[model samples]
Target: MGEVLWENIIVSILAFAILYFLLNKYAFGKLFAIMEQRRELVVSQLDEASKTREQAHVYVEEQKQALNQARQEAHEIIERSKQTSNKQAEQILELAKEEADRIKVDAVREIESEKTKAVAELRGEIGSVSVKIAEKLIEREVKNDQAQEELVDQYLKEVGGRS
Candidate 1:
């Protein structure tokens, strides 16, 4: 039994040493290299994710700037349109005022011309009536010059009152 025990111990120790050496030289190196490669892949993927996040942030900022610029341009366009409309309205108002003034002046001139024509016609009628009255008085027999003059004055007064 003692001899068997010694043999068993020696054999177990030798086997353990040999196994440790073999794993250290071959399997352990390959396993560690594979683990390192996996770690590097994880790190590179993390870096790529960070870069993509930054690019997305930049894109969002650019979109915001573009939206702001478009808003400003739209505001300017609306303001310009308002100004143009106001200017047009002013021009139309001015033209209307000018036309009204022209019409009023023409009406006043026409009224003056008609009034002048009416006055001239009245004067001509008065002259003809006076001439006819004088002819009638001359045809009638008169007693005295003073009486005829008085009758002529009275008739002239009556005609002037009627007119």
Candidate 2:
């Protein structure tokens, strides 16, 4: 009975040791390798996500720079248009001023010509009136005394010569 009990205990211990060795060599080792591979895959995915995020940020910055450049170009075009418009306005104003000056000069010339014509006409009218008055006075005096006409003509001739 003692030998049989001892033999049974030894067999139980041997079975436990064999089970432990099989689990460590096959099940536990393969499970641990699978877990390590999954961890590495997750780390690689995180690294790829970080790289994609950085690329997205850089793209956004480039777009912003392009937008700013476009805005600046638009502003420059507007300023150039304003400058051109101002220059055109100045040219138009100068042309108007020149036209006005030309009109003024023409008007002054016309007025001066009219004034000269009026003075010459007035002088002719005054001379005709004086001649008429002198002729009427001489006619009146000559009818009264025909002998005095010869002496009056000689005296008038001498006065005209002096003037």
Candidate 3:
């Protein structure tokens, strides 16, 4: 009975060795090749995903920089507009002041011209009245034109000097 048991143990070990050798030579090689292909595919996919993530990060940073630059440009435009408007306002005010000064000068000149016209009219009226009064007082018409003109001139000088 002991010898049969020993023989059965040896036969079982020998069958296990043959099965392991066959599987290593045929099944294991194909299985390992498939597993290696799957591993390489997963690694390539992961590398591609990492590269995509890096590109996405770079794009986001570029967009952020562009947004900031746009904002800065907008701010500069606003500042320039403000300065331009301020200059325009100052120019408008200066033009208004110059126009007002011109108008004031024109008004002054017109007033002086009118005053001179009024004074000349008053002198003429005074000279005519003096001539009429002299004719009435003397009870005669003055005959010499030169004498009458000289008399009127003298009277006008006296009156002008007094007032």
Candidate 4:
């Protein structure tokens, strides 16, 4: 009975030791290796994500700078267009002023010329009428050619002065 008990205890200890060694070598060690691989993968993934975030931030800033440049260019274009329009308007105003001045000058010249022509024509007509009237008056008063010519000349001078 003593030998049998001693044998059972020894066998039990050996079986437990063999099972612990097999679990450490096969299942537990593999599980530890898998955990390490998973930890390394997670850390590498996190690093990649950080780099991507930084790149995205830089790209966004670049886009913002481009937008600012576009805005400045648009403002410049608008200012240039405004200046062009103002210049055109000034040119039009200048042309209008010149045209009006030219028209006024032409009108004044035409009026002066017409006035001169009318005055000359009126004086000529008056002189002829006066000469005829004086000749008739002298013919009735003197009944002589020399007296008629003198009277006509005097009356023509008087009519020219009145005119």
Top lDDT: which candidate number?
1
The candidates, ranked best first by lDDT, are 1, 4, 3, 2
Tens-digit lDDT string for candidate 4 (1-163): 4356878788999998999899998988899899999999999999999999999999999999999999999999999999999999999999999999999999999999999998998888787777788667956787778977877687768666766
What digit string (tens of lDDT, one per residue) describes model 3 on residues 5-90? 87878899999999999999999999999999999999999999999999999999999999999999999999999999999999
Winner on lDDT between 1 and 2 is 1
Clashes of 3: 0
Q: What residue runs in model 3 are displaced by over 4 Å at the alpha carbon?
A: 1-4, 140-163
List per-candidate RMSD values in Å: 4.2, 8.8, 6.3, 6.1
Encode model 1's per-residue lDDT on 16-123: one tens digit a residue. Answer: 999989999999999999999999999999999999999999999999999999999999999999999999999999999999999999999999999999888778
Residue pairs clashing, model 4: none
Which is the leading candidate under TM-score? Answer: 3
Q: Global lDDT for candidate 1?
A: 0.90
Query: What is the C-alpha local distance difference test score of each model?
Result: 0.90, 0.84, 0.89, 0.89
Scored against the true structure, residue 100 in model 4 reaches a CA lDDT of 100
How does candidate 2 score on lDDT?
0.84
As a whole number from 0 to 100, the lDDT of residue 79 in candidate 1 is 100
